[model samples]
Target: MNKRSLRTTLIAIGIPTVYAVVLRLLFGIESWANLFSVMTVTFLFCLPTIVGALTVYLSDASKARKTSYRIIAPWIPVFLFFVITLALALEGWACWLMILPVFLIAASLGGLLGGYLKARNMNNKLSISTLVLLPLLLSPLESMIESLPGTYKAYTYIDIDAPADKIWRNVTRVMEIPEAEDTGYLTRTLGFPRPVKAELNYEGVGAYRKAIFTNGLVFHETVTEYQDLQKMVFNIKAHPHEIPSTTLDEHVVIGGDYFDVLSGTYELEKLPNGIHRLHLYSYFKMNTTFNFYAGLWGKWIMKDIQNNILKIEKQRSESM
Candidate 1:
């Protein structure tokens, strides 16, 4: 390539890269900021000369003077120069940032080639590599951004075999396994421990009383709402771990639908065979206001509890 052409390549590719990395460093305490940076970088690269050319091309319009692709000719080199600069700037971005430049370059070049094919009215085989790639990268960037949040609700249709009334009987009824297979800390630690039966205080309002995990993680959770067996909302005021966060003013979680730290609140839905779906959605903040003290053992205990709930439910259904 000639000296000017080489310079054009570098500028077109490098500036946005640098801006992206800098913005990422500033905003990315977590993955949230990185996503924003990715979008900014993409937009800045695409907008520079292309948008400007489109703007100016439209602005100076007269009946005798025509707006044509020839006017956009100068923008081609200017746009490519900026794109190279943007690409060079991206060297500082995270490892993931390097993937976009090549595709973007091809996309920019592809547009130019498409314009060539348009006027000639000939079968021009467009570079499929660029055609299929730039948008794909943009898609993943958007997807990762949408996934940053802690939790959200998912809706799906499920047909249950049993009637809502019969399902409600099974769901509302908490099983109490009196004759457990095993005995104390050992019983709770190892074998089958007695099941402490739980029932909701109100039809669609208060706690269903959550499951009893081996660790000191049990809590009385109240329902936010209940529509027979169709749905139930509840909050868990759980001490997920035996220990607490080492901070001043000590994080204290109170029991109620909304005010609990270590405790997790969620919803459950039963549809029309024997199918039930659980929704673990929460819109709560975690600051020094309530320190989370999830110990290693506590995490294990919770996992076990979650798994065991299925087992307990299976046993209850079979017995019934």
Candidate 2:
């Protein structure tokens, strides 16, 4: 590459990356200056847009004219920012995985805007400066707005060629699950702890149960309603303090400040074909300014965990 192109590449990639790292470090501090937060709309949405705009604005005008270049070039630096944060432990893999889609899209939009300004030969310097400083100015205001907690449900089911009684037995007290038996695609892909086993002392209302997972994560459950071989309802609680810090990212930790699982239910329905359909569902809460997006991931993760357990229950019940 020529010196001018190389310079454009470095400026496009370096400036945004440095800005992201600075913001990340600033957000990590705990004090009155808490406006720079990682969980806010500014960080998740605006920062990436600035990164993209800067990439296009700083690029050589000739190269920026290509429609494909405008869209894809910004992603390189955003991806580079992702790698740097993960490598430095500034952010966790799970958190990055969740925000990656948003970052890429916002960056592309920023690039398009940059391309437009370049084509018009607008006052690019002033515009780029404003965009670069936008997050810093907006985050404090965004943080001032209180995050409202929202409750959501993730429901899943599986059909088993077994009697209700057989399914109930497995549902009430799950045996130790072998690693090979786990099939939670999303959870496993995101590095979430896998289900290990669950133990219930008895089968009735007010019964105590413990659901164990890998990496020392545990869910304490108390039966609230019960119908023999038909339905079971339990309140689920996971103490963030009890869970190892390495098990989950703090931003998405179960029972943490931002997200939690509230309860779970299991119902068995006998179809006329003499098959039992086991229904599993869980209620989860998310307290974030961006619940509209975070809730989607929350539901997906809960369903994956529930479906994993349901699959194991189906196999075990059918084998009986």
Candidate 3:
């Protein structure tokens, strides 16, 4: 790249990133100005869009000969911002992974807007300044609007070749799961604690069960309804205070302010030809301004975890 291009690149990427860092710190402060929050739509969506617009506007890359280049170029700086924040520990891996898609898409859309403004020879200074300050200007108003909590369910099942009794045994009390048997792709990729074992004192309603996982995470469950070899329902609780802080990002932590698991159920239906289908389902809650998006991820992670357990149960029951 030429010196002029290099200078433009540095200015475009640097200014927006520095602005983002400052905003992040300011929003994180617990003072009376708590309305400026990182969890709001302004920060998640609007900030990145502004970053992309600034990048395209400053770089003048919007005038590129290739339309594709103009569209895709803004993402480079936004991705760099992600890398820099991750390296600085300003953001956690799980949070970044969840927000990466949103950032990239929003940035691209902003790039398109920036290109349009440039093509029309609009007042670059005025437009860029407004875009840069948009998130800060809107965050306070957005924060005043409370986020409504939403409840969602994740259901998964597997057909076991074993008898209903054997499936029930495994479902009621999951044995110590070896690492090789764990098949939870999403949770594992996000560094979530792996399930180790579950201990149930006895069968029937009112019984208590402790589901233990790595990194000192535990789910306390109380059986609310029970039917021998047919179905079992339990209310699940994971106390955030009791969990190790390092186990999960605070934003995505189970039973934390933003997300939680409420209850779980297991059902065994005897299919034809002596096969038993085991169904595992759980209810989770997401209390975020972006529950529509966050809830999708919440369901995916829950399904992955539940499916992994069901797979293990199926393997063990069939082997017996």
Candidate 4:
């Protein structure tokens, strides 16, 4: 590539980094990491890349240099992703890394879209208009995205070598989960509570149980359906302050204002032999502008929690 093209690429790459710093300064570090915040930041980053690619093609650069520039365009935003994430981490904002993939994907896609539009000989006036209207468009688009109703479920099942009856006994009231039994990379990093134990006050429908977690977070579970060894349904009642956060924003916690652990169920199906299929299901709510992305992380974290509990129950029943 020619020196001119190289300079353009470097400037394009630096745009997103500078944008991120300015965003942090404007919104503060904590507010800069939400779904809307990340999306807006990514959109702003894409504008420069789009404008940069257009500038390269419209400039006095040679045909070969233009071709080379288009080829390397996508990486500009990706490079920005790494640089911006590193900056956030250095500032003690590593929690933003959880959505690193989102930012990277957004950058890459935006760069490609920008290049595609430029290649179509789209009027520069239209491109400039898009940049002007894009921010205005995002506010309502985000609301529409968040307003879209969604009921998401996470299912995890394990085949235990124990009888359904034994598994039921263990499932109804899980014993103390030792600290060693609670080692999950994501959960540990997010500071999610580990289940200590569970207690039931009654036996049939309308019964109440409390599953305690680390850091004083407690879930009040009220049984809705009771079918012995077959199905158990319960609703989740939780308080936010009891949960901890890895960031200054407590909204990252599951029970926070924007996210919730709605309800859960456990089902046991006796197989042809002595084994049982223990199914753990969770239904959650995400009242956020980025439910799609939030739901992804929510399912992962819940799946980890479910598997941990099931693993212990499986071990306990097998040992019995």
Candidate 5:
């Protein structure tokens, strides 16, 4: 808690905190459930800079620069702990990503310490190295965490009584759909934002349609390929977060905001006693900002579609 140590603590804590506050004030806006607000606050509160700074200040760097492996050689346990925690928590190989970068940082920082200690022939200098190592590593790591964009999801299904052939007839007929009323307003399937509208000549591939929203959220969904009852594949413009740049080229539609395509099959299967299954898969990404709270809004909206189909199509099941 001496002058140098206190100064180190303030610098580590202050810089990250000030940046967090400024960013939040300038650009961070809270959505439905205040998910970003809470996450942003929590992230800033745990800024690791202070911890790394203290480690550096306490070490006797006078001899710190001389030592070849002064801190890292002994701190293998600490490195292993973070690595293990990351691996266990993150899905797939994402966890291990943090480890190598941190290790490289340690090697360079601790290597510098190693060189210093070797030159001066100094003894143990634990404090300074510990502080310097993590900041050199953790700051970049933390920034990456903050920048990752959230993901969204949605699902909808419809059952038809007539043969699978009849169902396929109606599925691809975009113009044939009923004007989405108070309820049928399914995903991007309905109202379709602003100047953008479904192209009337959209008989097949290469069809480009746009949906514009007032809040600067426009998305474009393009039809890549189309075939009879087999499959329909489409590509959406990348999510705002998919790239380093923030402002998307234009807010045409809710491609990622809502799903891009509604795909299904014209096949038969067993649903119940003497009943055939006309199974279908609606492909689309939910158009909504995800946060810890407020749950999944798009999914809830889609649940209505499932209920609608079951309600509208229920009479056919009973009649059979």
Candidate 6:
């Protein structure tokens, strides 16, 4: 690549990288899973196209628009992958592998659009207009997405050297976990409430239960399915203002309009000889353009919480 071409490439990559760093590191933006971040992703998608077209416009004015597309098409993914790695490392985010495909697809579409605009000699006008209006367009899109319906699940299991009956007691009601026992740094850092103790108010279907989390957040659940010593399920009740934002930014709450935990399950299965298997499951949904990306962090956070509870249960069950 010529010096000018190389300069265009570096500037295109650097601009987005700096924006991301500011959003995530300085401003404490949690994840690329939010609608605002998705808007940023859309910006990144269109950025390379503009850069490519501008390169042609400046350097080779008569170059075919297809040539610009061809030169920049492959670099879109390369540049994005670099940004993803940098973000993941700096922010300790999740699911880069899965989010990569979404980024690639968005970049491809944006690059094609940019190429078409360049072909029609409208690249500059369109690029400028899009940059100005994208944030505005994304606001309503985020709202619409937040209102859509989606349900997802995460599962975690452990084998205990004890009987099913022994494990059931701990599963039904987790005792007061000591504050030290709660390894909450992960959730706390992300502004998610830490898991505390859970209390069950009666037995059988329609029974009431409360799962108390840190930050004064509690989940109210109604027993939907109950079986003695084998399985238990609870349908989550709508709990308003349950998710708190521990960050300076007010827009990153994982609960409320952005995401919700719908239900949860705990099960114990009898295994061969002197052992039992315990399973924990959580069902949730996120209303965001980047649901796929958001789901990754959701699963990790849920899985860690599940493992914490199961570890306590395993220790208690074996000793009993």
Top candidate when judged by TM-score against the true structure: 2
lDDT of 3 by residue, 1-320 (tens): 88987887788778877877777777777783467877778888998787777767666543543456556877787777788878877788989999989988888888777766666665777888888778778988887888999999999999989888888999999999999999998999988999999999999999999999999999999999999999999999999999988888878899998999999999999999999999999999999889989999999999999999999999999997
Worst 10 residues of 5 by lDDT: 243-252
- 152-271 in candidate 5: lDDT tens per residue? 344444444555444444333322123342234443343222121223236468766442332344445565776654444455453444322222211122343323323322233546
Which model scores highest in lDDT? 2
Go through the candidates in order and give each one's C-alpha lDDT: 0.39, 0.90, 0.86, 0.66, 0.37, 0.61
* Positional deviation of residue 153's Cα in model 4 after best superposition, in angstroms: 1.7
Give the runs in model 5 whose Cα sits over 4 Å from its true position: 1-144, 149-153, 176-180, 184-219, 237-295, 301-320
What digit string (tens of lDDT, one per residue) describes model 6 on residues 165-245? 778878887788786766655555554556678899876898888888777678788889999888899987545554444
For every model shown, the clashing-pair count is 41, 0, 0, 0, 30, 0
Candidate number with the higher lDDT (1 or 6) = 6
Q: Provide TM-scores for the models.
A: 0.32, 0.97, 0.96, 0.72, 0.34, 0.61
Worst 10 residues of 6 by lDDT: 245-254
* Per-residue lDDT of candidate 1, residues 118-233 (tens digit): 34434433432343234335533653543221222222222334444554554555656453621223224423233465555557675465654332335556676766656665
Q: What alpha-carbon RMSD in Å does predicted model 2 have with respect to the real structure? A: 1.1
For residues 202-247, write the lDDT of model 2, one tens digit per residue: 9999999999999989999999999999999999999999999899
What's the lDDT of the predicted structure labeled candidate 2? 0.90
Compared with the true structure, model 2 gives a TM-score of 0.97
Better by lDDT, candidate 5 or 4: 4
Two-way lDDT contest, 1 vs 4, winner: 4
Kindly indicate the candidate among 1 and 3 with the higher lDDT.
Answer: 3
- Ranked candidates (TM-score, high to low): 2, 3, 4, 6, 5, 1
lDDT by residue (92-169, candidate 4, tens digit) is 333355555555555455545545555565585687457534644554355344444356898999999987789999
**What pairs collide in candidate 3?**
none
